[model samples]
Target: AQSVTQLDSQVPVFEEAPVELRCNYSSSVSVYLFWYVQYPNQGLQLLLKYLSGSTLVKGINGFEAEFNKSQTSFHLRKPSVHISDTAEYFCAVHEGSQGNLIFGKGTKLSVKP
Candidate 1:
């Protein structure tokens, strides 16, 4: 079984400041990792994914994540943030030939001016 854990429940940052959302996963077998973002009153959108090959994966809206196999971490980072970036971010993992995804509780990003 695979599971995801978001280290922080909420992240408050000033506009234009950098932010990092921590995500850790536990799995007995190889897994596929993903990050999704959901704006207010909207469905979750794919931010980035890591299935194979590159360890560093880039996503929409200036977001990127590095897949660390040894540590079992895939932390998302952005050089700067905007007020529009305020939303809920979820980390998910798929494992064992199943198409199902196990998601974290989520981290709320609150960007302020």
Candidate 2:
């Protein structure tokens, strides 16, 4: 079984400041990782993904994540954030065989001016 854990439930940051949302996963077998962002009153959108090859993955809205195999971590980071960046971010892992994804509770990013 594969599971995801988001370290923080909420992250408050001022506009233009950097932010990092921590995500950790536990899996017995190899899996695919993904980060999804859900803005207010919107459906989940793919922020980034790590299917294979490169460890560093970049996504929309100036967000990027590094896949650390040894630590089982795939933390999302943004060099700077805007007020529009406020949203709920979810970490998910795909269990290869079933092609099902297990998601974390999510981390709310509140970008204030």
Steric clashes per prediction: 0, 0
- What lDDT would each prediction earn against the true structure? 0.95, 0.95
Candidate 2 residue-wise lDDT at 60:
95
TM-score of each: 0.96, 0.96
| Residue 94 in candidate 2, Cα distance off native in Å | 0.4
Write the residue-wise lDDT of candidate 1 on 48-109 in tens digits. Answer: 99999999999999999999999999999999999999999999998655588899999999
In the range 1-113, model 2's lDDT, one tens digit per residue, is 67899999999999999999999999867779999999999999999999899999999989999999999999999999999999999999987667788999999999999
Candidate 2, number of clashes: 0
Provide the RMSD of all predictions against the true structure, rounded to 1 decimal: 0.9, 0.9
